[model samples]
Target: MGIIGINRSPSCGVDITSKNDQEVAGEGVFIEILRKKLEKNISIDMVGIKVLEIEKALIDIQRLINTK
Candidate 1:
């Protein structure tokens, strides 16, 4: 799981294990790239599952946003 998380981080950029040390930028860009890569690697069935997980995470973010 740790390895997967690291691989999914924007820090990975276009490389498998490379890290992006951007001094400036929002997290959205990083997440978007990682998600695109993940979708490209997995099957359609798995994509659905990953989408659901993303939806849940978005919901959680909404909650946090509301709290702010």
Candidate 2:
């Protein structure tokens, strides 16, 4: 299974997360934990979903699904 998260969240964003009102490129808290917990499995994909970039997110999700 895969997981999708909001890209603008401070704790859940996967790529473009907000920090002090400024956007930064990095992983969020939950993602970090999940990664550490699921490091043994490489087939599970994780992606970030952006509100403004819905089309891109959809495409990414589709790709993830196709991989599985």
User: What does candidate 1's lDDT look like per residue over 1-68, in tens digits?
Assistant: 11122223344322223235533322334544656676787522111112236775455445544553
Q: What's the lDDT for all of these models?
A: 0.37, 0.82
Residue 36 lDDT in candidate 2: 77
Pairing residues by index, what is the TM-score of model 1? Answer: 0.25
Off by over 4 Å in 1: 1-52
Best by lDDT: 2
Quote the positional error of residue 10 for candidate 1 in Å. 17
- Lowest lDDT sum, 10 consecutive residues, model 1, at 43-52
Per-residue lDDT of 56 in model 2: 95
Q: Which stretches of candidate 2 lie over 4 Å from their true place?
A: 40-43
